[model samples]
Target: MPIRVDLLALEPNVPGRACLTVKKWQGGEEQLEFSIQRNQDGFYLQDQKAWSNNPFWFKVSRFALAASGEALEAQVGPEVVDPLLEGGANSQFQIELREQNLGHADKGVVRPGVGLLPSTAGGQTRSTYGGVDLSAPVVPEPEAEIPELPELFLPVAEPEPEPTPAPAEPVYTPPPAPVKKSKKGLIALLIVVLLLLAAGIGYWFYQRTPAPAPTVAAPAPAATNAEACTLDSMNSVPELTFVQTCIKAAPDSAKLLEIINQAKASKHCGVAQRLYANRAQAGDPLIANAYAREYDPKYLKASECFPTADNATAAYWYETILAQDPNNAEAKQRFEELQK
Candidate 1:
């Protein structure tokens, strides 16, 4: 069965997804472009169907890393996927195709409606911001009125004559006395009017009052108790936090590169490889020499520990050396050797 390789590493990228590029090699020893995908529970290079092909060997292979993610200048967090269990070898973890064909044999069953891993903030915080509401407040337009039609003229009908009425007796009529206004009633009316007037004025002031100034949210404080990365902390796969600490501690420590290239940095290989890659790209002879000292197969195959090669980086450093001093025999020799 066809197999695909995934090399996980830090890079500058959009959060909430992994950025990956799938490369295909062709005739003339050219590596052609394949698919590039942003994985979220999806495999790179190949799809679920390709992975499902029966009779294929399944292996975790290596936790190979490239100087990606952080190299792209992405901020830390939304951790990298680690394939190892406690003290498990990234390379030693493997199995026959067996029942692994249709899906990941070792992967945990996270059902479709499964809940997210719990945290201090409960479930993941969703975005509070969104596109403008369809019903957002706006100045309302006046409703249109239909035009009135002119009334049509009509003829009036004649009325019939009324019959004579019988005689009726007269009734006495009484005159109404002058109305005397009570002093208490007048006072009460005046008080009510005054109260109403006062209330109206108060309402007017309240409406005219401006809304309180909008408050700005304060920035959260920096975390103090960040995980410390000692040589002892190299047991587990290095996460973004560990990578960040290594960066801040020694942005360019050749000694650290030596440890990492030799696999002495242990599983912190990703972090060390990243740091070394940065220096290797600097094109400085001293830096290159320091790096090449460890990347050389003589030190120990860097590819054995890390998924990538420092030898591939050697050409750049050697070329940089040649550019500075064309007559430099050692640089020329190494550059020529790498070319072969």
Candidate 2:
């Protein structure tokens, strides 16, 4: 049966989230309900339980909002619509069509090319002196002569000596100005002596101060996840929450593997999913392949964690593995088979 999706409600006022109801057209009275929350890149599925029973369930890679007529619609996926139907069933939804529309004046018109030409001719013209007459005689101007003047004799007169005036009294001599002695150098030397005394007192106090006594720090107890939850607690409390936290808190891969094996033996199916998922996303090919098997159609029938198979999810994880290790034959084969 084809799947049907209906929009129930948009988040109040802000429109940050959308609630949707989905169901198979002829499947039964059963229906799936979930919410999608907006993120920076797009939107992500918030309710996993909505499609938990769907064998063809897959991750929506992207979502975009669109307006159709008067109503708004969310276009989701470039994913396979139906896993059972291969080839042409694979498609993507685009919100709107972008067309290159040219205006009436812009259509089929070619602009003319402009060529530059010189404003004046390039050849040289005749010089200005070329028009003047050069054939005239070269005449030189004559020098003029001046007349000489006669010499005249003049007599010298002798003057009589007058009485010498008395010498003026010597001006009173003023006493030399008193010399003032500078005290700047003396003051500077005193300041230096005071600084030295201060330094000596500081050294004396430092010498009298005794060194701190040596002490030892007590050793810390070895840290372990046992404090969070234990296998024994599983039988008593059986709380999945604590078990998951303990699984994440397990120190190394070896410890994590130990916890996963024990959890499986105790029939704790979902505990290992998050544990393996964390490492898979961190780019571990082996862990990613193991995580993929949890949803793989070939293996899900036997899995306690997943009752129904999801080829899309398994294919997604397989593709993740291939991205990191392209030569991985298992992941490549599984991904191709899922596509078919």
Candidate 3:
């Protein structure tokens, strides 16, 4: 709190409205600032109102007395000093500053207690060294406290969170495609070929089986007499060939029925059956009914020809008769019985 500066001059002998210079040592030279003499004080300052706290006192511990050199030794520097902010940190180096020369540190004689010793020179100092008034009060100036500096703050930036990666999709995997059985088509074709071959062989066999030729019946001898009309002479009748069929149709219907009945009664049942099969297939009403009378259930007796009382050669001829003559009661009843 001690002031270590030279007391060069005091203007008007008053503390009010005095322009003073504050000096600081930097690089071994002085830097001066416009300041105020707050009171009859130890240090030059800028303004008295800038300090609100009661001033603290620090005396110059360096020896002080009558002028020791030709230069004015105004002991006006700070006493009991250590740098609180050295390299921006608290430091602990004991220091004691003795004096400071404000500006024009020449010729002005020193004063012991009252700051800025009185002088007059060149209108800057209105009094000389010999003009100082020793009668004034030597009240020492009060010291001031250096206010602690407000702390500076800097903002720090924050890092952004990294985006999380999406989960990987499952890979698709499929089973190998099944091998097609190439032989299956060939096998099916072989079976179809074999079936066609078998059918061809059966058809060939059926074609090779020869049918019996119609019996080449001998010609019928002319009726030599009524004695030729006997049953034994009937065997000599012409074969029922195409020419003989015309000769038979040459007869009257009554004669044709008589001839057919004789052929039937002569035990030529095969020929009769053939006649019935042909007349039934030909849809002849009279011949089909006549044939029906032989084995028709309506006319049946205990005869082997009508076994099961079935109409002759199946009910085919009787069906043919009734198809043409539905009013014929015999054909209708016999056809119905054959249905059973």
Candidate 4:
């Protein structure tokens, strides 16, 4: 039986942070999860299982990684297959790898070791401020000189004769005292008037208020969540959500085909791509071939959801089919064409 490889998720921003699930069916089923990272030389596969300790490094050229396979071994070497098969090297063992969104990985850079090295400390001590004269001597400023003023002569007049002083008594006047009035009765009357006014306003408002209307029950929501999971229903946002939920629920091949047809008719490229990918990853050669054609240079269409044709991606899907059924003449021919 062939090994199954499925790409789970890939980080677009950090392309090296990709996860995959690999399963093999020979000699009792066994599966392993791995986190893939790229370095200068090639790719690194680290087993995600806690108990797994072996990590393998594949030279970039070995796996045709630039064109096809996700984690499959190249025809030349058993280095990749041996580790994956856990020493059960059946001559017939083959791996079908499915990947998506691998174009996000940046161009390779040279990191000479497995995994990422811790960032090194700063190389040299450097001053934060630049071009300062710290050694210059301090200079004292000179004080301003004062000039002497020449003396001037002036005449002084004699004081006027003293006038006779007369003492006048201050006029006696007393300020009027403020009058005090009793306000207890007035305050009490004002309080009583305010209370009466408030009571009258309250009574008026109470009489003017209208009675509550009878409660009319709302009609049932017409089982919106149960709306037929058709592609046409995708136009409704709520129904779209329901459709997505059902897609994830893993509908049968027939249901998937129905949805795929609806998607193509509606020009729902993204939905079609998703359905094709899901089915293709499940070892469905027919679905895989259909998906590969979507990216194939010859059959690809700009009007489809995939506006851009990618020969590399088409080759990858074709390689996946070939791995499963080596005698698939169509996949083999198209794969060779894409390679050239």
Candidate 5:
């Protein structure tokens, strides 16, 4: 026989909350809590608080069930759980059980009662012999009859039904007249003539335009001091003269910022350091250390000279300076101060 599981009650009052308490035959107890919400789609259980406007928002606390054989206990809530079944029948197991349809609007607390087995059943023996005690308080009747009542009669006041709406008049559509093949043929000929004319005009223009004087690019300007100071020159030059020229060309703070950016991009730490120092001397802290100091001392000193005793900033500069010039008394003292 096919096993049937029915949801006896689903109470969806107390919106935004759900809880279930179950007592197992082995004398174990479990509790579960969950939230409920509703949306345009349908009712659903949420792990967190659901909105008040949720149409499906309802709280369900208690549920009742009736089965053919022994009464089974189950944990209920938002979480899914495997159903308890009889005779070790895995196929009969119903999973993810939840209560349903006490009413859509009946949101309230439920305290379901669990029927207990009678003590006389082999004096609470492990195996209750051949048949289970149907009289047990835990097992309740599966069906209860609800009588239907006759409707009350009332004095009738008859009213005529409204007339049906008239159908709309149909619109008359005229069929398209057939085109003259002669006219179509003439139009086709004209289109072909226009295409040929366009092609002829294109060819004439192409021939008239002397192939754009083979654009002879002007010879590149002889490598000047400015061009020579490129990233490639940083390693070749002993003192970074190109970098100094760049600084000279950079007339104001705005230009200085640009030069600093170029130095950083080239990975010219030493040049970047000097650029920062220049910016610091000019009182531009934002540019000095922001890009340079994270590297070695040459970069750090440039950053240190910039005003601003920001602890993290000072720490990096002081550490870098001390690492390179351990004997430099000023650097050592600053390192010690920053460490503290």
Candidate 6:
């Protein structure tokens, strides 16, 4: 039966000058104090007591005897086995070292007596012999041999001859003469020349044609002070100032037209009044009337300046105003009168 010992259990006992205290689990607690001291080459436990005849189980609570002592548990056999006595002179107990497979946090079991024994000197412990064996056998070599060669040979054969015949009279024929230069080449050359002449004439005509008198620069009109003053007034006023400015600056401008159209459509009375006043000052009675109708469709003053004598225009404006503001009794009456 092989003896097992936890190599990890002895980890605390590795460093030189360290003390370990082993506590036996069997009955009255017995403390085994061991000190790790440097021998000739390596470190070994020193000052350790020999085991008693009893089969005692012990654990190393702390090897360094530090505050948190490490535990190394072991089960010693019943025999008074002195490992130092077994291994020759000057040998120490080879604590049969093996890693503990202690599952998880549990400490693993160590079986002693299976490991190498230490050498002893005059009843004192000396050598440790727990190393593994690694010896193997060597193979022998074989002898070499030479190769052989072969011979060669040759052979011969015979030949035969034949007869010949006479030649016949020679025949000759002349090749056709080369052709003369034709009119086709002359015609092709004429076509090329004509094309070149036509191109040149086109270029000359193009050059001669004075590029239609470089468009006459239209004369800039004189600045109208009245228009400028109207613009200034339009800018100074709030609400409807944009519409007023548009009318003053560019009456026909689409944006301004849209703004006026929208104001009329929405029946914005204040905007319509401002628009009418601005357009009236701008000397556009037709536009003024159109805008005035947005506020007071029955406004006869605006009707009086109607662009069309048919009165249909005024009727349309009146109807539009009445359509937007049905409560406008004045617009309704004006519309009736215009119909008459």
- For model 4, name the residue pairs that clash: 40-109
Off by over 4 Å in 1: 1-229, 232-238, 251-255, 258-267, 282-287, 293-313, 316-329
Model 3 earns a TM-score of 0.27
lDDT of each residue in 1-340, candidate 3, tens digit only: 1122323333354221122211222211222222222222223221222322333222322332334332222223211110111011011111123234433221111111122222221223222111222122245787744343334333333454564564597555453343133345556666876777677767776766789779898896644433332345457543233212322334334544565566556654433443443444345677667666665556654332233443223354565576577787876776666656
Better-scoring candidate (TM-score), 5 or 6 = 6
Query: What is the overall TM-score of model 5 with all chains considered together?
Result: 0.20
lDDT of 6 by residue, 1-340 (tens): 1121222113222211112222222112123322221112333433243433332223333233224343334333212123222322112232322222322121111211112222221221211222111111234575533222122111121232232233365444343232123345556666876777677767766765676677788996633434422434343444333443344355453444455545545444344444444443334435534544533434433221222233443454454456466777866786677666
How much does each candidate deviate from the true structure in C-alpha RMSD?
A: 18.4, 34.4, 79.3, 26.2, 35.5, 51.4
Clashes of 3: 16
TM-score of 4: 0.37
Error of 6 at 310 (Å): 10
Tell me how far the alpha carbon of residue 273 in candidate 3 is from the true structure, in angstroms, after superposition: 2.4
* lDDT, candidate 4, 1-340, per-residue tens: 2344432322221112223333332221112222323221233443431112243322232232313333432231122322332211111112223222222111111111111111121221211011011122235697644333233232333464564464586555453332112244546566876777677767766765778868889774632433445654665544224334445456677767777767777776545654565567557787788778877879976654566566656776787799899999999999888777
Return the candidate ranking by TM-score, descending: 4, 2, 1, 3, 6, 5
Candidate 2: regions farther than 4 A off? 1-223, 226-230, 233-250, 299-301
The lDDT of each candidate is 0.36, 0.41, 0.37, 0.44, 0.37, 0.35
Clash count per candidate: 8, 0, 16, 1, 6, 14
Summing lDDT over every window of 10 consecutive residues in candidate 5, give the lowest-scoring window: 82-91
| Residue 224, model 4: Cα distance from true site in angstroms | 9.9
The candidate, 2 or 6, that scores higher on TM-score is 2
Better-scoring candidate (TM-score), 1 or 4: 4
TM-score of 2: 0.34
Maximum-TM-score candidate: 4
Question: Which residues of candidate 3, in runs, are more than 4 Å off?
Answer: 1-233, 237-239, 246-252, 301-308, 311-314, 327-329
- lDDT, residue 319, model 1: 58
Better candidate by lDDT, 5 or 6: 5
Q: Kindly report the root-mean-square deviation of model 5 from the true structure over all alpha carbons.
A: 35.5
**Colliding pairs, model 5:** 12-107, 13-59, 13-107, 13-108, 115-138, 116-138
User: After TM-score superposition, what is the CA distance of residue 284 in candidate 2 from its true location, in Å?
Assistant: 2.2
**Model 6 lDDT at residue 40:** 24
